[model samples]
Target: MSCEQVTTTYINAYYEDMEKLGVRRATLEPRATEHIADIVRLVDTLLTKGMAYRVDGDVYFQVDRYPAYGRLSKRNLDDLQAGARVDVDERKRHPMDFALWKGSRPGEPSWDSPWGPGRPGWHIECSAMAMRHLGETFDIHGGGMDLIFPHHENEIAQSCGATDKEFARYWVHNGFVQINHEKMSKSLGNFFTIREIFQQSEWPDTVTGEMMRYFLLSTHYRGPLDFSDQSLKEAKSALNGFYDLFERLNESDPSHGAADQLLQEATVRTRTAFVAAMEDDLNTPNALAALQTLRGEANKALEAGLSGEMRRMVRQEFRALGVVLGLLQTDTWRFKGQVPQRASGDAESTAKTLSDEEIAVKLAARLAAKKSKNYTLADQLRAELASHGITIEDRPDGTSRWKR
Candidate 1:
């Protein structure tokens, strides 16, 4: 298949999966079809500086000319030459000379260039595209760890040679996702696409886009993540635990609990710990652990009759932390949309599920208790309804509404 046609087939599938998976993107920039001016401009500058040469319509970057060519990948020129693809173009003086532009071939897209009608070489594509959108220099450049050797190394050479400045402040390379014990690749028949993962029937419940993201986040970015039915199950279950805690506290009034000093101090400690973890090379594993620790501390306070205000304080703290890690963005009652049973009396009993008429009568009785200066009884009724999964909100017009 043609390269453009083959590329489009997967790009289409990519957007569809990302949309369904709730992945948000700010912009989409296609590098290949972006105007060729930037690519030609850099190549021209290199040629003027004697870093590039043309032969038989092909342009090659002289690796020996750039002293710091292998600095990014931490290798010497001789080491690269030992494994260079010298046979591809024997006309080049050095074995490690990489192509800057490839002469047009049959059945391939071509664009007018200084050397001849040709296409930008694969290595130059990123440098041209990034400089066009970002600048002569950018903050960070990242790709999979596999690209660290030649791809990223060549990009550094081209960018620096043209601009005479640092190409990127930071170079980030992430480890690959593995299937079983092996690296996921097509030749091994172990490759699995995003859609295939979503279709796996072994997921705990319904496979959601959020679940897929959660699975990816379960491992640290620097560590190799193993994908399997068992691992996915663990990720799904862990995410569900967060949702369960959110729903449990959603209806409870923050004003009801008493001893809150324990929760207040714990939340402060948790925040400090979370920030420290994030600053340490974006240690997501430790950051996620901090979130889980906060949850545990909050639940401990809940068990000890922690004040409702303190309870909400803890919830808000953890929720803010979650936002940083890109988790817990959904509604609290998302999974609880199923049939809810009434809970009442001491936060554990099967309380009476009230109908509309029953609700009106109970609200009226609770209002009477308040009028009679029975503050304790009024609060009790509110708590009773809350425990039953029914939330009573006091409206502005001195009316109460309940949702179950």
Candidate 2:
């Protein structure tokens, strides 16, 4: 495929993966290629402001023009210059000076610009895209910790130099993700895609998309997240607890009696704690702990017999708080069936024995048998499913639930 086609395919796959993990779609989506005009304008502005210089068809940002060049990365110009790698091209004003535009090479896509046919540099593309969509001074700029250096620093220098304003009010750089306590790299044989994680035969239990999402949020964003089977199992167990509580709430009647003051207070406290944790640098681990505390209090209240109104209020608060973390939003009944199950024998083999659609078909057949008063067929189907490591729970309303 062409470069543009490959890029589109990757972007589409990324959106699909995000959707699978229950992530909401972004409000605005902008592509660097689509904003070539904006990029060219920014580069031209940099050139006019004497912040960038053109060499042949290539335009490079002059780091010497921006005094606060290394402020974000917190390194002195002398230090950067000392550590800079020797480049064959000696046209740049400074060793640290980076490209704003690059002349097109053979068999490469090119855009028409005042400085001849070229494309925006890697760093300039993001700055131009952000300014185009979010204005010259946006609230936040986020990326991996690796980007904090040359990429983000260059962006700050070029953007602020051109616009004469702060590029962003806040810069949030998240830490890396490790696999099995080691750096996740293809060379290390530990690199895993989202699809690979869900479908990997190494794990004994199935990994659902939501389970992966939960495992990600269980750690603080600023800290390295160590991904392992144990970590995933912990995440699965935590989600099961929340879903179990949700199931209880669903079963309870919500139209009778007054609200319990104690439960109401607990819910309020949980909300406060959840907010406090999030406000403290997006501490997801603490926020999740707060939710767990609330879950415990909610369980105690449920056992102590809460009034219908109080139960309803508690359930509403749980869902409201969960919305902030993108958790606890799925229907309890529907989600419970999706939870992974572990049983005797080979897990991979057992998991493949029954697809969700196949289970649904069997459940329908069992229901049909029961309705027709053919108890023998229904019992036989139940036994057959149980042999495949599936558990079937028949409800009073003639509905069936299965988990595996």
Which candidate wins on lDDT? 2
In candidate 2 the C-alpha lDDT for residue 300 amounts to 80
* TM-score, every prediction: 0.78, 0.84
- By TM-score, the best candidate is 2
lDDT of 1 by residue, 221-331 (tens): 777888887776677677766766665556465455655887777778888888998888777778878878877877766667766566566668767887786677765
lDDT of 2 by residue, 1-404 (tens): 88878988998999877776777898988888899999999998998998999998999998889999889989988998778676637887778888889999877889999988888898998889899889999998899998999999999999999999999999989888998778889999998888666555223322366677788888888789988777877887888888778766777554343336677888888889899999998989899999999999888877667776677777788789888878877666353344344332455445545667788899999999999999999999999888776778787678887754
Please give the lDDT score for candidate 2.
0.81
How does each model score on lDDT? 0.75, 0.81
Model 1 regions lying over 4 Å from their true place = 1-9, 84-88, 201-207, 253-255, 333-404
Backbone clashes counted, model 2: 0
Our tally of clashes for model 1 stands at: 4
